[model samples]
Target: MSKFILNKILPLFFLAFILLCFNCDGRDSIKKNHTQVLEENNLIQEFSEQVTYIPETNLETVTDTLLSSGYKIHIKTYFNMDSSVLKTRHQDSLNLKSYYRNGLADVIISTDDNVLFSKTITKTFIRENLSKPIEGLKSFILKSIWIDENTALNGTVIAIQMEYCIPETQDCLTFKLSVKTSGEYQLKQL
Candidate 1:
């Protein structure tokens, strides 16, 4: 009688244990699904699409292509622009406007893979085709209120503040360009 009871009760307990194990929480799958949703929604893109920078030197042994020697200046730009929703009656007008806003700019100067200087500029705006129809809206403009440049001897360091406007019209936007250091190798800036 005892053996019969043991066989029946043991199987019931074993089945309950198996069910519990199968129902246990598995968070790994949940996290993976969340990431997939973000990618599908265009909330996060691959690194190449968002990161841009100038390399110090480019040496292609196979193609024999070479870049000039100098400190490589890397500029990474991030902007929140919803270009998908832009609509205009004129097809050409749609092509002329830039929807760049809330820009974040990162600048890094490096040589031989060693970082020499780094700076970040935020709260910048980029607009294209800001002119009137008569004047022809054919320009790309960057505007930033916070801008300055430092100079060094034997090197040209210039930070220019530019806002080109039609003197007859008040249509204008701000821009900043800097060449912190210019030499045989560090002559390029953006």
Candidate 2:
């Protein structure tokens, strides 16, 4: 009888206990998940409080259009969504997508009569003006743009702000690009 109890009953008891643990949703796993979510929310609030507030251009988040002295200047920035390499490539190769997404813009300046200047600006545009290269920047974006119309002070009619950011993080560097009415531009760290 003792042997039977040890052989059959003990195994059944152990099996029941294991199933109970697996079925319990009110366990430590749920507690840990809840704790992690709370921590993430706190971190988000902290990041916002520490960072300088910058306004976002609601117009496509990448498009800016302004009219100055009868010259219509249009700026558009886009990410290369056609590339499937981000999905197919390994983790180490994912950084390549950053180049396609960030640091490229189509700048067009035209008037009611004809197109004056049309060019695609690339990463070299930023690197040439920067004293030192920005390291570990996963992506960048044209955060906002506005017509200053104050060419008398700095020969810049339009002022643009661009942000360089780490992937999925709050770390970033902001740059100010001053653009003249004649379609020429200059960049400086801000």
Candidate 3:
């Protein structure tokens, strides 16, 4: 009788051990899944925070009309190549100029002979030296302009430029300016 009881008790203990292992495995899997979900949520939140929001506008016609109306316009310059230093020659030349505020190029917006807005941006020519090929450069300014505001109508303009210097050369490259306008105007979406 004692031998029979021992056999039954041993089998019951084995079964309990197997069930405990399975339960532990299931709990581990759940914890892993939970951790992955939390990490994904954090990444999404971080990405959303990095996003910038811009208001919509329709302003192509208005900008064209403004341009045709003889409003002095200029675009910010950008360096197409890769570099961050400025050539000495270009820096000296810009320093001698006085028309633009702070001796920098400016985009001028005016109406009826009154200056509406002007954005001045300092640009660097990326070059190893004054005679070297341009690699790229950096700009220190960014500006957004509002062109018009009326009932059921609004407009905005954006302009940006950047420059850089090549290594071991004096030559520099200047990037073309980028300009955008939006509002009741019919501007192309970028």
Worst 10 residues of 1 by lDDT: 58-67
Task: Give the Å shift of residue 82 in candidate 2.
Answer: 7.0
Candidate 2 lDDT, tens digit per residue, 8-31?
999999999999988886565565
Tell me the TM-score of each prediction against the true structure. 0.27, 0.43, 0.22
Q: Which regions of candidate 2 deviate over 4 angstroms?
A: 1-64, 82-103, 111-117, 138-156
**Stronger candidate by lDDT (2 vs 3):** 2
Model 1 residue runs over 4 Å out of place are 1-69, 80-100, 124-172, 177-190
- Mind giving the per-residue lDDT tens digits that candidate 3 earns over 121-173? 44432122234442233322212223332311222443323332233344333
Model 2, residue 5: distance off in Å is 50
Best by lDDT: 2
lDDT of 1 by residue, 51-140 (tens): 212121221111111114444555555443421112113242122222223334565555565655465543221222122222322332
Using TM-score as the measure, what is the rank order of every candidate, best first? 2, 1, 3
**What is the Å distance of residue 147 in model 2 from its true position?**
5.9
